[model samples]
Target: MNAPQTIIGQSPALSAALDHLSALATIDRPVLVIGERGTGKELGAERLHFLSSRWSEQFIKVNCGAITESLLESELFGHEAGAFTGATKRHIGRFERADGGSLFLDELGTMSLRLQEKLLRLIEYGEFERVGGSSTLKVDVRIIAATNADLRGMANNGQFRWDLLDRLTFDVVRLPPLRERPGDIEELAQHFAVRMSSDLGWSLFPGFTDEAMETLKGCRWPGNVRELKNAVERSLFRWGRDDAAVDEVVVDPFANFAGPFGGDSTAEDLADVSDSPERLSTGLPPRRDWPIDFQQCVTEYAKAILLEALEEASQQQKVAAELLGLSYDQLRGLMRKHDLRTRPPRRVSNPRK
Candidate 1:
């Protein structure tokens, strides 16, 4: 995160993005950040806020998809005491909390039909009412939302509100996934490793050895940067000796990565002249095309966890549990019921060429 608000890389696409971010900072309009999960939508929001005039105020965040439909309204618009079950205390929702500041609505596409209507009005009028209260309260908050889910696509699909979508985005910054920025993976890996080591204790990571780094870059990383971070953490745990150095980082992401694949990771898919004949040798099955094995329920759960992690490492079992304040072991056990796999991962290449 300390690597300057604008991300850095030698690639023309990445450099272009960095240049764009610098210019985009001067505008105060609502900024919508779009990308695959773990691509740092929130980081983009932080950069937007810090660059704006409202830097002096609060930057509140709310994940619309995290809350149940029943509670989402109250969480965003506040609610009078007794608004619903366990509503014993009067609550001020994210909007009011972010009054005079910026409110970051993550996963904004998950907002339900009813909630979307209320949100649209708030954006238009800068006012809203607590769920159980009739008195409309006004806020002077700036809106900055980020989502991996395609809100515009959802709106067109009728799952999201079109009017709300337009209101939420006047300026959108779409970030390419890590696969597009292979040039920056080293920097990102180091950043996440240092941060993870600090929180979990350096002892948690023995290293991301050169071999591990090769494996990591080869991974499809369906979960994106956050998944890469988790992979680094897991790699240390999987292979690290008790006395190993924390910075001796080695990663093999393809050893176990699994999620929906959208590119030509398979050699057959890319028979072009540039295709490399080498494979990552994850020891695991070809995840994207692998057959399902559900003979046991525990295996089922494992498969689900692996899939979830591959697609949304930022919200897979571990991250989801943390967001809900639950123990990871419990969730890990639950993951056993979903038919997850434990094969090795294969690395992928930058597809821009």
Candidate 2:
């Protein structure tokens, strides 16, 4: 079994969550972890499983929202040969595989009503038959569910099963969002910076400037901890060096778009542009009485951004790719598409005396 990942942060909110999680770990009932996206609900589930008696057994995970209803049913319950067109052989399901262990059901709120009934059966009695098999299989498995949705509201609205919600919420752990736990921002940012630097082959990690730290702490992270990690890593990649510290940090690229358009537009204005159908449908005004090709305009704008990123990186393709949030191959493909090439800077010749 893999060890539980270290949960970072010392805020009162985080400390309260850990206390509840520690108490939940001692019991053998179903556990439900609720939190916003990127707030680390899955980590809480792992902590529960690893701290329980079933630590040595398999810890199977399934993203309930990522699959269709038909596939989810087959995934949770094994399918027999010729089970609904594509089953070639008898396959065991996650429940059977995680027998005497733990099964982590992520995005539990997205589960269909029908599937919720089947899940409730498993919770009530540890018995389920395969898709096309008659044999009823029994398994002693602990279920640790995680979701960003309000399961109680979902149940009240008739979208989710009330009984399943009641069973799964035997011990509930709600992780606080990053904005609420401001104390963790700097620590998590530094942690991400060090890890990113090591991954990028930097000999020394750059430290965040005081101003940059303040900028990070003030922003409202809608994406929470995951967004913070990405922002830190991105800032490090774009502005950091082995010998120098990061002078500034960009928490959000779109947040600082005031300079290009003569300072008339704020970040909120740019964000609200999508809500205007006139802007999206009409695009730019007609030039020389010719219809504007939005696709071509977008392509040219993207190429310009790529060119600027490459130039800023001193013609280093790898560094430029990181700055533009593209993979090496993706950057190369764009370069080829736009006929962009890197060339050495020309040296100036000296004038004769």
Candidate 3:
């Protein structure tokens, strides 16, 4: 079967993952996909569905983490009219909708024990009852479960059902994080850059310099592919001109860094230090430095911290403030003082003919 276009990578790890998915697609058994966030678990699920015999049927995805426990029950199992306080009509659940096809349960680890029991029944007997209905319904669905959490560990601790794990583990596919596949970084970065450029309707797409590419390949991406995609898009968004070549790709070093101390220094920080006068002729700091502007230095430091927090929170000011241990007002005050407002770069207009 052909691979899905959404899965991008030339590394050996990615190839192995695709092979596993393809091999298991021919069989009709439950599959458990293990990987870190942004590691393309959903893509793996999709590939399995499209490559299987039930490709023509619906491929339904339900995020167990996004839905609350109370709602999850009704979401997975259909509800009869007047079943609960909010139920006004009969509802068809994901299992029914995905009957004779595939169902991708993302963040499966977050599912409650009660829901797990119901899912276990579905997998073991192909039968389930609605939240409020008395009749049992059967679905011929191929289950594909994905999670970043350790399922075996959870089972050992009694948080997850071992029976469910056993059923879903008929075939397992583990995806490697981006850090382990360094060779694919450039390819992925370029892919995201081109895609983002097209999305913005720019006449010309900017090309990354050698230095920028090196910077991208060197940094540790904790959030995996999702983080890398966001960083590339943000860099392109901040690229001021369409005609000029992109000299450097801007990546936030502290994007994944949390806790009291900031993560590692970013490429931008190294550049700042390299250009500072504090460095002597030997590229080393002078033992006795000249007097510096204390206020200016404090302002710059605060602005850098603020920017890092904002990047870590994906530009969410409230979350950024929480990360910095400051109130919303205080965060806003710092942003205004440093003129560190976060806004998308204006599109570069085409020159008149």
Candidate 4:
């Protein structure tokens, strides 16, 4: 099997983490990899496994943060037949299945306290019993746990067990955020652009001018690689004013950051009007035809945008208004009308470009 070529990154932090992973690839100890979501902690774990002596064995990935408490235990430790009402058959747990292989647990911080104890026990003794079975089974599986959340903070706050953390802390690997490693942005962009072109039949080299790339770089990507991929896809499909030239792709990633997330739209969710071809939220959208004057509509819309910007800017009103391109007075008036007059200064400094 060939190695994956999709993930292109060579930043300092990534290089250092790779160097450490390369060094510890064959150790088979519990590894704790930490990074923001979409920083590819799972990819790092795979790199470790594939580069190690266990390359020929299985590499299982589990999202500890995703599964619910009850389902999680059953998921980790294969349940015995009739372990609970839904257990119709005996199943092999991830640990047993990955014996002599690797088990990558993504978002380890979300595991419940009871599940954490079970995980600690599994790491300590290399053993675990089925959810309902009394017999303990031993397996030689390497454990690689990761989290985007602050596990250290969780441990400090007593949300996470000190002993459990200690057991999982044999080797620590930290991956830098997309914002931190500026050099890798271009490389990753090219890589993802090509992937987009191949997978979605979009332009191979994105229509983003050098100016556009700078905006991409300036953003604080809350969703990281996953968000970038989505943005690229949307640019190909939904961007432009329906007059995109062959080489002129006008994907305003800055605009994607608009309405609520990246900009100071007065509406907490301008995404209802976002160019995306889907609904922004689950609930019914606000009525477009309010039986009122246009001024009221703009004010109402501005207020919503302002509320959303508060979340992005930590409740700073001035920053929110500026993002909306509104004058301070105008913002204040709208806020007063909406009963959101209280606000801190807008935090926008001069644009980077």
lDDT (tens digit, per residue) of candidate 4 on 1-353: 45633346778877887888788896868889888888888888988889888888988888887889888788788999988998899988888889998889998888888888888898888888998999989999988889888877999998999998888888898877877777887676666666665666544444455644654555556677766656556555554332342222223345334344334444433333332423222233367765766545655565555676555555654554455554343444445445674455456654211
- List of clashing residue pairs for candidate 2: none
Question: What is candidate 3's lDDT per residue for 121-219, written digit by digit as tens?
Answer: 989999998888999898899999999999999999999999999999998999999988989999999899888888888886768876567567755
Name the regions of candidate 1 deviating beyond 4 angstroms: 1-11, 195-209, 241-353
Candidate 2 on 53-98: residue-level lDDT in tens? 8889999999999999998998998889988787899888999999
Question: Pairing residues by index, what is the TM-score of model 2?
Answer: 0.74
Residue 46 CA error for candidate 1 (Å)? 0.9
**Which prediction has more favorable TM-score, 2 or 4?**
2
lDDT tens digits, residues 155-257, model 1?
8889999887887777788877888888777777767666667666554544565644644555557778778778677655554454664432333334223
Task: By lDDT, rank the candidates, best first.
Answer: 2, 3, 4, 1
Which predicted model would earn the best TM-score? 2
Candidate 3's displacement at residue 65, Å, is: 0.4
Instruction: Give candidate 2 regions above 4 Å deviation.
Output: 254-353
Regarding lDDT, does 1 or 4 come out ahead? Answer: 4
Query: How does candidate 1 score on lDDT?
Result: 0.64
Q: What's each prediction's TM-score? A: 0.65, 0.74, 0.73, 0.70
lDDT for every model? Answer: 0.64, 0.79, 0.78, 0.69
With a 3 Å backbone cut-off (N, CA, C), the pairs that clash in candidate 3 are: none
